[model samples]
Target: MKNALIIALGIITGAIVIGGQSFYHLLTSQNIVNVASGEVRLGEVYDEQLTTTVTIIGDDNETPILTITDATDQIVKDVKQELAQMVVDANKTLSAHEKMRLETAYFDTNVNIELSTEVEYHSQYQKDMQLTIDETELSHHASEQYHFAEAVDMLNTYASKMDTIYHQNDSFIHKT
Candidate 1:
């Protein structure tokens, strides 16, 4: 009976593993194909925090400034979504460890709007868009420094290559 039970457990585990891999493959294969074919554009992902200023009309009321700020926030949100998708697609080819590292990583952007009286009536407000990513913690441990360094290099190389590929061709194969 014990031997039979052990065999059953092994069979179940095997089935689960196979099923999980199949599901993962199904989910990731299309993204891999899309990215490889350049159907997905990853050049829009900013490497670091980006700050831009958009001017608004100077007026005593703050609604216009808020509106501009909200729009800028939406733009940042869109960029973030693009970046996340790029990461997901790129990670499909990475090892389990590398994918885990990237999955744990975080990126954030903030938009700040300020009224500028110095500007003329047509452009009286300025909005600042900031994007930020923190990697210090990932490399803080002495034992893990090398791993983090490699991960950073890998990610940078992938991003640069993808960005170039995205801009240069509409349907080029992913060389990386």
Candidate 2:
């Protein structure tokens, strides 16, 4: 029957979704993925190709340099995993939909940090220490900008449940 087939599809789709979630949790239970990439673009308007280079003069000391590059460093995976678990434990009281939507939204934000820097060291210093960033670097913090909008719907109705879920005073409460 048409109705029977529709029901079967729904059930199959739901099972697939749950299984996919379980698999994702299993893989990410201990760690999550963070990748580094560049953010470089040539303007859409152009008449011809262009490449420009400028030279700078400096003493044996502090100086500023301008360069175009795309590189990334990572934060520790365990720290990120712990944060994810904390967030999950924090919001477990939410319905499955609420929990997933919020987590997805949050994870999207905390990963990439981009900006610009001008470094100068008159004396010897570690390369990492010389790093600097300008306001333009953080062009996107999607998770922060949205700020738990997905879970807003459930807060009033499920506050008590959420409180109970996030209560980490005892390990048993969040064990499974």
Candidate 3:
């Protein structure tokens, strides 16, 4: 009986030790898994933030430029149609030179209005881009700042071209 009791006690003690070790291992492995999962979540969050920022900047830079370009194209088409109609309706008795002068005057007066409006819109776009660049400069990310700078430079170049067109048109109008 005494031998049986000793055997039972040994078995119980061994089971306790094994169970305790297993519990300890489980806790440590679970902690490691949790830490790894947390890091992965953090990485996902960081990527999401970068993607969102880039998308916002792209939209802000591209949308207005496209809108203005489309508007300018439409205005040009309308002006051409109007000028062609005017030429068609011009008095048949006028000399070709006189007719040309009259057409030039009409185009200068009417087209200038459209050009001026476009220039004004482009100028406002430039200002808005400058503001976006200024705001982006406050961010810690260098990539974002670089992108904004590039966008601003492109806007400046486009604005300069528009200005040149307006000036050329103005000079021609004055000469006529």
For each candidate, the alpha-carbon lDDT, in order, equals: 0.36, 0.34, 0.32
Segments in model 2 whose C-alpha atoms lie over 4 Å from true places = 1-72, 76-83, 101-103, 107-176
True-structure RMSD, every candidate = 24.2, 25.6, 22.8
- lDDT at 54, model 3: 15
Deviation in Å, model 1, residue 127 alpha carbon: 40
Residues 1-176 of candidate 1 have per-residue lDDT tens digits of 99999999999999999999988866544321133334432222222221212222122334432221122223334333444565687679989877734345433222222311111111112122221111111212233323322433443443344344433432223346
Q: Which 10-residue span in candidate 1 carries the lowest summed lDDT?
A: 115-124
**lDDT of candidate 2 at residue 144, scale 0 to 100:** 54
Clash pairs detected, candidate 2: 114-137, 115-137
* TM-score of each predicted structure versus truth: 0.23, 0.22, 0.21
TM-score of 2: 0.22
lDDT of 3: 0.32
lDDT assessment of candidate 2: 0.34
Q: Using TM-score as the measure, what is the rank order of every candidate, best first?
A: 1, 2, 3
Candidate 1 displacement at residue 171 in angstroms: 7.8
Worst 10 residues of 3 by lDDT: 43-52
lDDT of 2 by residue, 117-141 (tens): 2222122121122212222222224
